[model samples]
Target: MHRSDSRGVFDALVVGRGAIGATAALGLSRCGLRVAVVAPAQPAPSPLDGPGTWDSRVFAMSPASRALLERLRVWDALDAARVAPVYDMRVYPSGREGAPELHFGAYEACVEALAWIVEGSNLSAALGRALSFAGVEDIDARVEAVDCTAPDHAALTLAGGHVLRSRLVVGADGARSPLRTMLGIAATERDYPQQAVVANFETGLPHRDCAWQWFGEHGILALLPLPGERASMVWSAPQELAGELLGHTPEALAERVAQASWHVLGGLRVLTAAQSFPLRLIRVDRTIATRAVLVGDAAHVVHPLSGQGMNLGFGDVAALLDVVARREPFRDLGDALLLRRYERARREAVAAMRLTTDGLQRLFGDHTGLPLPGLLQPLVGARELGWRFVAGSSWLKRRLMAHAVS
Candidate 1:
């Protein structure tokens, strides 16, 4: 690894090496800026080949997210055999008999795919390669302190006692962002009484490039198609249910999943161990402070029911690039007004996604014992009504499909 020079100031310093952080470094560097990425070095991931070797965690990449990666010349580097395209999506309202089903298709939307299912590691590896090819400096160290009081620039002190200065610092450090804390930004956080269990499976029947989702009394179950006859599962269940599911043996768990999915894909053979993570909604009033900007999970996090968390992070990178690329020549990259423009452009989209996902989680959450307020009791039937509405209206479906692809 090459050590970053402490004497020279950078145009931007990215403080994370995840997909969003690495991509931000590459994008900013491409715009003729001296960029450096700060993070502890990590060992290379094992090759993702051979049968049953698949990542447990994957992301459903929207067309817009794909476009951003393509522009950065990173998408093509991904192993095509591991990527799966979603031609259609079928969503069934809570396991009620005779429940209306809502369907969205790439054909109806007049696009190649509704979205693509990609392994998180696959995306991260490609981004890493692109960053190296782009000549973005990699500071293999942890940030120990931040000083943004400097009028023209911010300084990041590494744990090794080296100080690196930059006009702007990007905090793509993630949900529990230390940089966000150091910058004195406050985030509103709410924890959902649920956890998402994820794993990959080899199905007895082909998924046919379709994504399946079911809302049940216990939780939400989604099966996303993977290459070949395999599929990835993300089951968002209440805390107690998640614990039970996680405790089951691999075979027992597969059987339980098969039963929950009503044997739609026939018998399921577990390809990977199940892992779970808590779900939550995180939002910050402002994404920028002085010479600092927060992107990705550092700025906001939403429920995974919509599978838009990663997409939203990628969207942040796109918006940040646009604002920085189009800024007035006289204004520096970290100019307060320039940063505000970036914030303004992202506010509405982020809020809408947060509201949509969080609202759906609350609406579909187990309400067996809990009583709905008299006036709000209508929601008990709203789920079915909303599904019927979306399913019956072609124009509405098309409108939604367009928004999703964008």
Candidate 2:
């Protein structure tokens, strides 16, 4: 690597240019920080045969996340047609006969919409476009080494033998982030032993902008509305089950999904082949290390059943930007005090979501046995009460909705 002695110069260096990384870079740059983004070369787009080898994941943008994207000037570039607004959400607990299903809608809260479902590709592209327009330096190289021995500056070595220095390094890389490792930050990871099978299809009936979730015996399945008569499905199940699903022909798989989801979308036709990803709960011991901070999956990853993974990362971006924006002129951006402020702002929310999603996944995924007599009634009643808790409180719902838009 070409070593450089340049010190105390760069405002920040962001590693990874995926959705979270790109958004963080854009946020920092917009706050007047000279930022450098190091990202892997963009992979080729997927063919019509199946879900792309490159991540074809879609994200449900909460209101707060959307606002943050707008502030970064990234959301406007997205094609409106490709974006689907979720006006309502239906959640069902499997095998619960006579139990009232829970429903949430934007109208109930007097909001224009609850959230927007957008493809990961579109959001990434939009962020890239915004970054280019903002004149942020893009270093299309992978990081080989990182040194944060010095408090005022952290040094990075790229694969191409170029050394770059920055006041702060942000790890917005995905779960297995190289930057996180380079900084020696420990992560607690729990494999859910389940894989999420995702795909897109055309439904016989239009989704009407409603998102549905079914807590099935095997696992949770979510059908997120897409534009037109299309919708995206995420089926979380055991690895063996996922393999069985993957073994089926595209048409057969579509049929299986229809059955699993109780044919919620009517007759389903696969527009894309199914692809599976192993589900896991990962949380870094801390989001901040000396001279660096972690964002996105690098910081934490929860069950996708709630669709809060990316939104959590966006929360980090927002908080970090706010922290930096308020820093005094002479204070180092990577100073412990500044980093602690960012950490404090994020810990409570991240911890709450992690515990909440993890608890729900375990509770519903249990196939042990059903209760009897009085116990069963209370159990059913409690489920209904939980829904009431969610539906009754606009504060909680609005807080969640706000996260999606940011």
- Would you estimate the TM-scores of all the predictions? 0.94, 0.89
- Cα-based lDDT at residue 373, candidate 1: 39
lDDT of 2 by residue, 1-406 (tens): 3767354468899999888889888888888889989877888555322332222378888888888988887889986667899999887776666555657788875667778899887776778789898878888889989988875688888887778899999998799998898888998888886899998888888788999887757788889998788889888887778898879897898898788777878999887678888899898888898889999999999999889999899999999999999998888898899999999999999987786677656556534333323312334436545545555667756754444333
- Model 1 weakest lDDT span, ten residues long: 367-376
- Residue range 1-406, candidate 1, lDDT tens digits: 2244556889999999988899899999999999999998888878777767999899999999999999999999998889999999998876677876778889977888999999988998888889989999898988888998889899888887788889999999999888998889999897777899998999999999999988768788999999999999999998999999999999999999999998889999999899999888898978999899999999999889878988888999999999998988999888999999989989988877776666556666544444443433555667667557656878756655665676
Note the clash tally of each candidate: 0, 16
CA lDDT for candidate 1: 0.87
* Over 4 Å off, model 1: 1-5, 366-382, 386-400
Model 1 lDDT at residue 200: 90
